[model samples]
Target: MANPTACLLIIGNEVLSGRTRDANLQFLATRLGELGIPLREVRVIPDVEATIVATVNEVRAKYDHVFTTGGIGPTHDDITSECVAKAFGVPWVVHEETRALMAEDYARRDPPVEMNAARMRMATLPLGAVPIRCAMTSAPGFTMGNVHVMAGVPRIMQSMFEALAPSLTGGVPVVSRAVHAIGVFEGNIAEALEAIQKRHPDLDIGSYPFYRPTPGSTGFPGGGVALVSKGVSLAEVEEATAEITAMLAAMGATPIQGEPG
Candidate 1:
């Protein structure tokens, strides 16, 4: 059976404009990998309403789960909640519990303040969606169908995701292994690597090159291709990695158990 799949929809004008570098995709991908939900794709778009709606609907329909980050804050530019609501044809409404939580949190601050419209905006959500709680900021995210809207801030987004994680069911976690070799050229090993991949089609094998800065030396460090594998079965991943190691040994390159740190 196929494993549960997820897609990330990153929304923010700052991200598109290069003002704010995104940090959520890698975090979510790693967490989901541990949970066995493979993140199949990622799309980064601006805060455009129509584009967000279209993309949210597309990915939500195609994948088992859809995660959205950014554009859910209190500012005017934060429009992901509304776009996601539009995508699902749902009316956006104020989640009363979230509003109350925000109100209480604001009231408890050292400089007690009113829950103004701007702050209240954080409590709004698409009607019928369940709130994804955020302990740090009283402003919470929400879940609509397969779509999960989260905060743009890395810290708050992480908190909201933790709240929603227990509710999500995941498939068997993929077993991951890596076989590395130092100073082995990709061009020289391409043929052997292709044969090994063909032999173990079930494994998700990836070859990545690494670099290390040697100040005194002019050349890139003995960095080489890493043959990483992921599969439902540990034995299969290990077997494929072993074959790659054997291939490297035959080609006079020592295969290391892990990549260079």
Candidate 2:
């Protein structure tokens, strides 16, 4: 079966401006890949409601599944919940379960539970959305339609993703075997590699080259090339791998299978 296609929308000014590095994209991508789900695209946008809603609607319409991260906090920029609600034309209200979870977390904190209004804001969700729980954090994420909303924090986002994992459908996960070529540059095999890619369009073909002092036959200092091809179709991946290996051999480059260097 072909892997289910998915897209990710990362919402936050911090991530857009580099104030916060976007870790959630890679985390979710890895997790989804493990489940045989292919991530098609990823977009990072500000916390503005219009942008969030537009992106959510666009991605949700295109992919089998959509995920969002960030802007679900208690601060003013935290408008993801409301934006999602607006996108679906549903009422945004405080979900009881999330409120309970937040309340519990507040109770366990050092200062004790204050039940402040700002903290309680974390409980809001779009109507009919199913809550995706995070054991690492109090703010419960939620799923509505094809869109799954998760927290911005890495640990919290991971837990929420795990909670939602079982519900996703997937095919055989894409598996990859990389080959490294020392004492040669990518230019040496560029034409053959491009031919292989054209032959196996379904597979993801990538070539990475590292710079190092040219080593003699002793393998002291030498640059290398890394070739990686990944895909759900085992036959296609294997075929591409064989072609890549053959190309490397033609260039007299030793093919070291797996991770580069």
Candidate 3:
């Protein structure tokens, strides 16, 4: 069978408006990659229920797993849990396991936390969903069907992922190799790179230029470009890497193995 695929839905008006910089996507992407699950699509949407509902339904249907972050807090703008329930045609209710955890957490506080309507909202989840909790925070995240809803906070989300990853089985991990040439220009190597890419269609090859501290310092607009090749097969990666290195050498530019930064 093929590797598992996933989609990430980032929910929040703040993230979309740039008020709050998103930190969960990259964290999740790296963790998922390590687990051998390729995260194929990522969408950042507002707090609108309809948009959330539609996006959740769409990606969940397309991928083996769906992960959503943010908007699960107590504020009115926190609407992800309800929206997910609507998407899955399940009822959103205060989950007993989560509530018990919340109770235990607050009971130990110097000034015990209150489980008011606002605070109680944190314990709510879609019916039949399982909770994901860890030392990062007691505020639980839930997994409903193929969709796993998580906290937006990087630390908490990472902890939740650690707790959940072991249960999932993954295929062979995708491998990546990057080569940087200090004095090479992408324009000079574009055609060669394109040909190499065509020859290895299964690989994902990319070129990224690094700008010099002072423009035209080396008479080149940018310092150099890094050629990166990514794929699952070890032999294919090595073959593409060798081709890229040879091409750079032929052009009188030394291919520096690995990324610049």
Please report, as a residue range, the 10-residue window in candidate 3 with the lowest summed lDDT. Answer: 213-222
> Candidate 1: worst 10 consecutive residues by lDDT?
213-222
Q: Report the number of the highest-lDDT candidate.
A: 3
Clashes by residue pair, model 1: none
Output the TM-score of candidate 3: 0.94
- TM value for model 1: 0.96
Model 2: ten consecutive residues of lowest lDDT:
212-221
Q: Candidate 2: misplaced stretches above 4 Å?
A: 212-221
lDDT of 3 by residue, 1-261 (tens): 688999999888888888899998888887888777989999999999999999999999899999988888889989999999999999989898789989899888989888789878889889999998888777788889999998887888888888888777777788889999987878889999999999999999999888676653647544788898988887999899999999999999988998665
Residue range 167-190, candidate 1, lDDT tens digits: 888988988888888887788888
| TM-score, per-candidate, Cα-based | 0.96, 0.90, 0.94
Model number with the top TM-score = 1
Please say which candidate is ahead in lDDT: 1 or 3.
Answer: 3
Clashes of each: 0, 0, 0
User: Cα deviation in Å at residue 234, candidate 1?
Assistant: 0.4
lDDT of each: 0.87, 0.85, 0.88
| Model 2 lDDT per residue over 104-164, tens place | 8888989897878877777888999998876777778899999999988888888899989
Q: What lDDT does candidate 2 reach at residue 140?
A: 84
